[model samples]
Target: MSRIGKKPVELPSGVEATVSGQTIEVKGPKGTRSFKATDDVTFSVENNAITVTPRGKSKRARQQWGMSRSMVENLVTGVTTGFKKELEINGVGYRATMQGDKVLKLALGYSHDVNFEVPEGVTVTAPKQTEIIVEGIDQQLVGQVAANIREWRAPEPYKGKGIKYKGEYIFRKEGKKK
Candidate 1:
């Protein structure tokens, strides 16, 4: 038996969930999100909890069972507390700021400033010149936006200068001897 699949996802106060056919929708104070499960797995809402069960004793069914449960849990969490990702910029003259309501301007030692257009359902803000915060109801979108920003200037091993996630560690390398 799958340990994660066997556990039911509990709905906290102020959160609501509804099931329709192969789809499940969750509504909370923050927002509403929905997910569609595959035929290999079945989902149900009962007693303020959501449960995922496999349709048959097959490998695919078992795999979908656990994954479906996790998706439902994420939906509940997304609509309730939401998700956030923080990025730290390190380098000389490296900075970030908001160009407009939906654009982020970054200066990472490049010839010209780079403008990143923020997509819908996600918000990017720079509280400090070297710090960036990405917030949204969808966890995947928030993480993807953070990764895209970091890709522009990943931390280097020599000086560890560039953009990185807050609390992320960069292994340092020694320079060549003169």
Candidate 2:
């Protein structure tokens, strides 16, 4: 038996969930999200809670059992509380600014500024010159966008200069002795 699959996902007050076919829809103050599970698992909702159970004792069924439950949990969390990712720019003259609505202008010591296009369902904001905040109802999208932004200027260990996640630790190495 899967530990995570056994626990039912509780629906908070003001939150709603409906199951139809293989699709499960969750609606909350933030937004509404839906997910469709495979036939390997079964989904049921009762007592303001959602549960996932495998149809048979097969490898695939067992795999889908836990995954389907987690996906449903994510949907609830996304619609209710949403998700956020913060980034900190570290290097000299490095900064970020929001251009117009969906464009993010970044200066990372390069000769030209990098323009990052914000995708739909995700909001990118630059609260400060060195800070960037990415928010979205979908947890995967939020994390992916933040990762793409970091990929542009990943922190270098030499001087610990570049863009990094908030509270991320960068290992420092001693420079070569002259």
Candidate 2 lDDT by residue in tens digits, 16-129: 999898999999999989998999988888999998999999999999999999999999999988999999999889999999879999999999999999999999999999
Which regions of candidate 2 are displaced past 4 Å?
none
Clashing pairs in 2: none
Error of 1 at 74 (Å): 0.7
lDDT of 1 by residue, 1-178 (tens): 9999999999999999988999999999988899988889888889999999999999999999999999899999899899999999999999999988799999999999999999999999999999999999898999999999999999999999999999999999999999
Reference-based TM-score, model 1? 0.98
Q: Which stretches of candidate 1 lie over 4 Å from their true place?
A: none
In candidate 2, how many Å is residue 14 off? 1.5
- Evaluate all candidate structures by whole-model CA lDDT and list the values in order: 0.95, 0.94
